[model samples]
Target: MSAAREMLCDTARAVFAEAAEAGMAPVEAAGFDLLLVPEADGGFGGDWGDANAVLRIAGVAVPDLPVAERILSGLGDAPKTLHAAATVGLMAGAMGQALALSIEHVNTRQQFGRPLGKFQAVQQSLAVLACEVAAVDAAAAAMAARLDAAGLDAEAADFEIAAAKLRANRAVGIVTAVAHQVHGAIGFTREYDLHRVTIPLMRWRGLHGNDAYWAERLGRQVAGFGGRGLWETLTARAE
Candidate 1:
């Protein structure tokens, strides 16, 4: 990355970490949204650029304290209860899934006939978990970008947000499953936190729309201009 990009990422990481910490408190912090407010909101206005910057940091923090909900809620006139619920749901689900994976590794991983988190495979899983976390962070950033540019237009911004949530939701499953398999039998235990993320991941999959639903929606969007004729229509419209 360029020096400038690196600088921005570093700055965003710092602010996001602070925000994430505040978000984890027993009570929500004051003016949390103001830090990421768009100019239209009468604050130091920002766009997806700002939101993504914040989200990437928040993902790193993964505090599970409803940080994303509060941020998204503060953006407009008030967000509906359902909207806030969905926002927080996705963020919470993502964190839960990741945590579950870690717990699974630590418990089931046996090395030298003991827990393998005591060994190498478990360590590898941890690395993979980090990558998954980073991917989700990037997805959050991308979703914020679409929202900033397009507002809440269903075809544009909503679609992008849905896509992001969809990917994160699916990832919750993939990460959890693989981690559990690697963990062996102990991952199924009620004593594990892995279940916490697994339960939410399952719920989130159906909460909004699933992969097939979103895929169809995206397909229809591409086909809306007249199936294969969309490109022609676009060219003609441009002309």
Candidate 2:
């Protein structure tokens, strides 16, 4: 990450961490909603790349407010809804929290006189969970970079955005299943914070365009290119 991006992410992390610690609602977390709006528009003027980092941090915090939707509404013509990349970022954030919680739980919780993490079964499950999280994060990051480089209006970005959301939606089910399996009964309980991330992930997967929806869209886009145009279409840039 560039120095500027790192600093922005750090600032976002601090804001989200403070809000989570204080039990503040997501919307009530001050300054977050302004990150994506242009300064000329009476906002911070940060772009989608900056908002990508913010959404990841918010996902980890899993606050009660709709941070993703707020950012989307402020940044574009969308009807106050979570866009594909934002949804991916949100799921990535949730997976980060879930993975950390699962790791902590496995290391602390014991069975048969050893840490749960020491068990081979648990190790394999955790490994899969980690891979899923990494995949979603990578896809979201790629889409963010694409958007930043091409400008948000560039139609060339649609394929990558759709692919990221599709990958994220698919990964959520696997990540959530593995996380819940790792956490066992404690994960399902309302008292534990795992539900905060897991529930939102589940809900977010169906929003924007779900896996099936994106798959169809992608297929149609590819089909329209035909055999001769396939390679160029994949590599094409918006005019």
Candidate 3:
């Protein structure tokens, strides 16, 4: 990340942490609602990359406070596709937190006179969880880039948005299962921090759109492009 973006994320981390305690008031006071608007329009003029970064932090810190809605408010009458793309970023962040919490639990919780992290089964579960989290993170990043490249036009970035949301939705079952499995029954308790991330991830999977919805939408877009056109378009978009 660039220096500016690093600073932005740092600020987001702090602001979101406070928002978690004080509700949307802290987020609104921080001006995240101007995240995607242009400076000429009396806004921050930050791109989707900036919004993605802030949203990811919000995903982990203030998952229930309408952070995504506030951030996307800059776009009047935004399409569902854009909201779906934003949800992917939030899911990615929450999934990442799930993995982090799972790892922390496994390393600390003891079983059979040894730390759970020492067990092969626990390690394997964590590895799988890590892969899913990485996939969602990659999908979210790609979607954000496509949205930025398309000037935040939902129609132009529909394919990426669909794919990202589908990828995130698909991973939810595996990620949450593996995270909770590794953490055992303690994960289900209200006192644990694991619930903070896992619950939001489950909620986000159905928010914006669900797995089947995005899967079919993605398939239609891919079929429209056909085999060769799909590859060409993918490469062209990457370029």
Q: 76 in model 3: Cα distance from truth in Å?
A: 1.6
Better of 1 and 2 by lDDT: 2
Q: What tens-digit string does per-residue lDDT give for candidate 1 at 1-239?
A: 44544565566555555654454442244444664465675754545555455444444344345555666666565433224224433554345456556766576645667875676766676777666656665666555555555653334555455556666665776676665766667667899555545555566556556667666765675667565686774354233
Residue-by-residue lDDT tens digits, candidate 3, 142-239: 88899899999989989889989999999999999999888889999999988998888889889987888888999999999999999999999998
Off-target runs (Cα >4 Å) in candidate 3 are: none
* Candidate 1 TM-score versus the reference: 0.57
Model 2 ranges off by over 4 Å? 17-29, 39-43, 79-82, 226-239
Q: What is the C-alpha lDDT of each candidate?
A: 0.55, 0.79, 0.88
TM-score of each: 0.57, 0.85, 0.97
206 in model 1: Cα distance from truth in Å?
2.6
For TM-score, candidate 1 versus 3, the one ahead is: 3
Q: Residue 162 deviation, candidate 1, in Å?
A: 3.4
Candidate numbers, best TM-score first, in rank order: 3, 2, 1
